[model samples]
Target: MTGRRRWTTDEILGTAAELLRTSDAESFSVRKLAAALGTDSSSLYRHFRNKTELLRAVADRTLEAAMDGYRPPDGWKERLTATALRLREAFGQHPQVAAIWGRYGSGGPGSRLVMEEVLQALRASGLPDEEIPARYHRVVILVTALIASEAGVGALLPEEYEQGMEQFRVAVLGADPDRFPALSHFAREIRPLGVDRRAAFDEIIAAHLAQIEIAIP
Candidate 1:
């Protein structure tokens, strides 16, 4: 007789996650996933009753991968920045998974754990218990907003966009010196600094967290 195969839940979720990472969520199917795993669709159904449940599983796994083993730093600001940056990196690495994460409710176990960590961090910083929820929400908003912005959606422009910026630079510097003294003086520095995008993101997150600390008290 043929031996029965055994598959752990992590194995199933990991396989689905790998597929989702490479392909769009819309194109992923249980039959295809099962085939990829050397099993049949029935086996997948046994693990996940429906596609929605499967997606939740996928999201849970993805978030766990994103947050697992992250240790907060000594300073609250640094810790907040680290958390935000890590979250951004995770989402950016798996754009498809990030899209799914943004849609789901944060009531999932992984999501709750993340919130707990944030609250604990804030409380450690001397925030009152009553204010921890609001503070946590602000941090979540900041991180999520930065993640959405960093997704690079609608930010890239055609070659003409670059040409337009150049033209604007020229027009400003070419104007009468009296009209735009600052532009004339710093025309060279006015050009894009070509800063590393990831570093710039970290700076922005750090700045935002600093601001939050001031407002929290």
Candidate 2:
């Protein structure tokens, strides 16, 4: 963390990412990140003009790691699903890193590469030149929305939810059965929103793929 170590741009960004995650991105600042790095704000400012630029760098790093060694599945449906799952796996680690979305200005090389893969997959699936753009938009929205929402939630949630779920169910069950019959009946089912996330992801990906099927015929 000492400047005597001569921090590299990548090293600074990686540290900044950890700091952002630790603070939940709500109150992150360059000064805070510099403190975490054991350096002064001016040093960080030299590499990144401001927090926004630094965050963009962190987001790009996450994006790059996610897609670096990825190999798409054989089928278009599988390839798209694989990509989404892979992205979620990486993005989930630095959940707060998502603060850079859209406001970060069209993303860096890593995001562009990810988008290219999606476009190529759609085209390879025999989607018409005209339909490819629309499909790309839909697919990107689906993937980004899923990852961003889940990662944001995961960042705020505690490591354990079992006890929380039980508490929630108990509270719901306290309601009068007759007046709140439906709520009482489904209390156990709605215990916790958490479940097999991979299955949930697959189901969402499948639904999107089904819609894209129309483009094939």
Candidate 3:
């Protein structure tokens, strides 16, 4: 009699990742995964010791997907921006992955390798060897913070959120025009700046590069 083929760890992980992307992570359980895979829940434990380990593996796989096909450009600034955008796109597509990314130490192989490349690029851009690590940490922290914020808050906002802010600013300035002369004079400009996040990201990257250049000499 022919033996039944078994599912490999990669298949299991890949399937789980797909589920995560398509559904909420909280909704994914071993039973559901097994049902999706046409197997028993117990089979997954053979590959992953527990649910947490499986989740971690899923997160690693997600990071790998994010970093896939990322090649650095000639200029360090360009490379940094590209890497950040790649990560952003990856997390934006699979926001569930971002929830756990910050929970783990910044030592996952994929994340570490990306950081190492960034450090190398910073060094090439005239940053001192001793300072590269710190600067790299800063870059990672800043980019990840942005991603985490998006994941946690999501894109949804009440229709009144912005309008409410604007109303409050105008009301406060109108109530005490002399008390808040600057705010009253620049009420429109003072209302949150309405900066496009992509533009802000580019500006932050440019500022970092400028700092690196200044520190080089």
The numbered model that scores best in TM-score is 2
* Tens-digit lDDT track of model 2 for 82-104: 78877888887877886455346
**Candidate 1 lDDT over residue span 1-217, tens digit each:** 9865767778988888788766766788888888888988887788889877887777766667678998878977767666776777777766666666665534567776677678777887777788878878877876766665554332334564577667777786686778878878877666443325578777877776677678666
TM-score of each: 0.71, 0.86, 0.73
In terms of lDDT, the best-performing candidate is 2
Candidate 1 ranges with C-alpha deviation above 4 Å: 105-109, 148-196
Model 1 per-residue lDDT at 47: 80
Q: Which 10-residue window of candidate 2 scores lowest in summed lDDT? A: 98-107
Q: Candidate 2 lDDT (Cα, whole model)? A: 0.77
Q: Give the range where candidate 1 is weakest over 10 consecutive residues by summed lDDT.
A: 148-157
Candidate 3 Cα misplacement greater than 4 A, ranges: 1-5, 22-28, 105-108, 153-195
- How far does residue 191 in candidate 1 sit from its true spot (Å)? 10
Q: Quick one: how many clashes does candidate 3 have? A: 0
Tens digits of per-residue lDDT for model 3, 28-68: 68888888898888888889877777777777776777788
Order candidates by TM-score, high to low. 2, 3, 1
